[model samples]
Target chain A: MNVAKRNNVTVTGQRGAPVVMLAHGFGCDQNMWRLVVPALAEHFEVVLFDYVGAGRSDLSAWSEERYASLDGYARDVVEICRELDLRDVTFVGHSVSSMIGVLAAAREPGRFARLVLVTPSPRYIDDGDYRGGFSKADIEELLESLDANYLGWSATMAPLIMGNPDRPELGQELTNSFCATDPDVARVFAHATFLSDNRADLAAVAVPTLILECTQDFIAPREVGAYVHAAIPGSTLVTLDATGHCPQLSAPEATAQAILSFTGAAP
Target chain B: MCRTEQEQEPERAGGDGSLTQDAAFTALLEDSAVDLYENAPCGYLSTLLDGKIAKINSTLLAWLGYTREQVVGRMSFTDLLTVGGRLYHETHYAPLLRMRGEISGIAFDLRAADGSRLPVLVTSAVKTGTDGQPLLIRTSVFDARDRRAYESELLRARKEAEEARREAEEARLRAERERERLQNVLVTLQRSLLPPVLPEIPGLETSAHYHTASPDRLGGDFYDLFSLGDGRWGFFLGDVCGKGPAAAAMTSLTRYSLRAAAIHDPDPVTVLTTLNTVLLERYTGREPRFCTVVFGVLEPEGEGFTLTLASGGHPPALLLRAGGGAEYLPTPGGVLVGVLPHPPFTRTSTVLSPGDTVLMYTDGLTEARVDSGRALFGDGALLDFAARLAPATAKDTITAVTGLLHGFGDGLDDDTATMAFGVPASGAAGKPA
Candidate 1:
């Protein structure tokens, strides 16, 4: 089925170098890693891809029964790795994708070498005293937020947002078409992301893992980072001096430097 | 008052009056610019690139119920929103505005200072510096209390319409299933009223066919050939007055009574007289049930069969001879069964030599509509059809008549039943041709 085209896979940097696959989280596409790609690509082969139902990937491949759970997304990751015949690779995931990588690596341990989880949460809602940094009602509020921005993701506004033909300069600035997706597809992805609890799955990680946490992230607080680090034995947790959940965009240099040091790719 | 002063000054000193008017106009313009920014109809706010509120107009402040000192520097734009709105701003709104440089007509609800939600539509644009770098964000907010209420009402009505359409589709499917089930029951009942297979008569060729016009309604035509005793047989063909379950019930009664009466007395006239008494005793009310029937008895006699037949207001039986001739055996002055106390049934006799056949049928054949429903096929057409098949065996004659009936197509709108029997010609005797 052409896995590379279905997932919009793009490969760059030096050929024959060690491979580093970057996976984006919910709400945005692979363009979220654009800021940190150049630095990582200098020493390693960098790979970026959008999940099905996001970015320019084929939307027709999406089905509600298949994509209703995180396992479907994990299957996409495993298939993409198999399609490329990648071996001993390092995987970087953001937000909900961090859990997805854990699932993929566990299924095909031979394909992946190391894991990097950026501002991830094993669970978003508070369970017992775990302090996942949100209540059950708060996640429902996030679903309402998705509905409130219905007009933004509608097809009528997509062309205007993706390419401003009236102003060519604006079009040049928006080369990647960031964060625009079908509203129905986005809703299902949001439900799978925010409601999933992967606490038990974290113990199955067998590779060297690095968990990067932002100092003031409301979506994934420092507590969730510590929980993920403690759940995986011999995992290192590094707190970046950033304010938002997306440290790759907010603090790209530090995010890339941490990855380069862990993989021994930096000169 | 100003107009009166200007008019008097123009007459006294025209040059000084023009200079005073220009000075007053400049003062009015300066005052209005500042007032318009503070009290515009919609709210306006400007924020830093990171969403920290840098400046806000007084009209927006009044709607938020916050003083200038409390909000100007202490809160970011996300802080003023509800929990849901903050998530939306991070995931969809901020990322889009950063990429597109401008976004318009997005719905959001801001939590006011008193814990109330104020629905509003927001439009934002990035204000760039001279070097083509983003400096700050400029936002305009419009109150949407009335619009949101109207939108919810429209959404509710549309949902109701979709649900009703789904229910109607389900109802139509259920009714179709019910009709199919009823048709199955009618077909099974119709089979019970006819014999599964006709009995084989020794040394005689026999064949019968029954055609029903509608699957939904049970046809009332019936025919049977059964042995009466040693070297003799009794047979009958009839049609009840109507169709469906009521006619089917009357047909069942008529068939059983004729069989029982023939067992008691194999005489064709006496058997019919007994059936007439049984039907009249059973069905005699405002809606009297009656039928036209022909009964006959056959016995072997010197290389042929002797046939004695009686009619009760039924169509005359047709005879085809080995000598290449065909004609009807008329039994006149007969009355319909179940309609009178002592109706006289007419009796007749004929001999079937080798290859000679006698055929009994209901009026459904002659009464069939033809010529685009303009006229009936009539008794004359039946005689012509029988004559064409003269000198033919019993089975061959029946097959030819069946084909002619099929040619009528939709014109054959009633149920029909036909039975034929004869002695085989010469060497063909005792073996089917």
Candidate 2:
């Protein structure tokens, strides 16, 4: 399979410039990078793609065994890098994709130059001595809510989301394809994202990393960000003034400025 | 009314008829807006991007049983949810809404002023300003108490189905164990029906074998060697037409009757004739019991035995000679025993000289299948086998035929009973063939 076509990869910006690959988090697709991409494209070549089973990427490539863990997603990222012959690349990831980037960078250290984690959490379940912000039962209830909501979302959005891409609607319909996914695949993706524990993998990330912590992020709180920053060596920590979990959507200008400063791209 | 208002407006300078009508319409619209916001079916609220409550409808306040003064500008949106609902909302719901700019059907439990939990479905959207910046979050909520009740019922039904499937699997396993126990009991009973060891006849070597086609169903084939009287011995090999307890009972009767009749008369033909009369008389008007048998009486003669055999629709005996040659001692024209009242039997006599072996068997040998039942191990194959083992003792003959039967594997589907008698060549008892 062509890795670039499987992920619906779209590359833009200056030719032969430093590569910046942007990956979206759960509950969204590659379209979530709309606000941050325009600013980064000025100095660096920006690469964007959807994970398998999301957005306009091919859903036929999905299988239960290959995607049973975050490692499966990490393999896709490494394959994407290999397919596009990317090196010294700056990987920008949001939410769960942040950990995927961590795993990928640790596996292929020579290919990545720096890492940017947006509201990343190494562990979401709260342990005895650590506050990861959620309990095991809470995650179960969240899965139930997703099950109910995904059923409703599929029914209301299938025609407008799946078919409208070919024959574009003139007006009225929202163009952004966030949270557009098959409900079955979304269920498996949710389990893989929320239940993963990559705390031990933090110290193995030899590349320079920047942890972009949103001020009032409900998903990854400030403490989790501090724990990650402390674990990864030679990593910088910047707390944004954004009020929500997704600064890329809620506060994109601040998000772009942080990425530019950390990677030494022109502001 | 317009003309009168227009005339009166002229008196009150600068007061036009349209201006008076506009004031009245504005008053009506204001009253309708207040009533609609307060009494809409769904609850409405607006929160600052930080999640602090900015405004709330009277409908929501009524549902929570809280007054406006206690909630507005005081409680945040997540503060109203139960502990579990708050955790879920913070982790999943908020992230989704922030990324998508909107979220729908987020189920939560709101803790009311009286401490009772109220189920609700909430949808929220970020309200943006003209500069495309989010100003506040607008939310609408609907009661989901009925839907929660339905989901719980569905969960209960699923659990019940899982329980029933587990019980059915256990029941099937128990039935399989019971069948295994009964099969073991049948095997024990069948083993007891055959002789534990063949009897030793002086001056002659004897061997025998019995192979059952099924372990659960009792086989009807039987063979025995017994002393008659006064330098004489009687032996017989037979197969009943049917199987199980009925045929087993007939086999026992035939065996005892043959020995008794041979002792009284000491003649092979008369002994079989007596067995035919006994079976035909016992089962005349009932289920007709029948069998094919080869009965023999032997007398000692000069380091060997002289044998007289009677056949009743049975396969012929093979004589392996002392000079390394083998042929069948045919006893033709014999009727099937126990089927007719006066069935004539055929008698043939042969001498078991030193190094000579005589084998008597039921049709189960020639009728045995080979190659997964595609072909039969016919009588022609048995004839060639005996000729190859010429100058053989009784034990050697029986051992070779048993080995041939074992080679059939699953193809041998019938019970076989065979008996072989020889003179052992005087001094060849201790040597291997």
The numbered model that scores best in lDDT is 1
- Quantify how close model 1 is to the true structure by its C-alpha RMSD in Å: 6.1
Candidate 2 CAPRI grade: incorrect
Clashes of 1: 0
* Cα lDDT tens digits for candidate 1, B1-433: 3567667776754677667876887666666756787888998899986667898989999999999888887788888887767766766677667656888887788889999999999999999999988899999999999997776677568668978999999999998898889889988888887788788876688888888788888899988888887779999999999999999999999999999999999788898899989988998788799999999999888778899999999999999988877999999988899899999988999998888988888888899899999999998988888888898888888898888789889999899998899788874556434
What range of 10 consecutive residues in model 1 chain B has the weakest lDDT sum? B424-433
Best by DockQ: 1
Per-prediction DockQ, in order? 0.41, 0.15
Best by TM-score: 1
lDDT of 2: 0.82
What is candidate 2's TM-score against the reference?
A: 0.60
Candidate 2 residue lDDT tens string, B356-400: 899877777888887678888888899999999998888889999
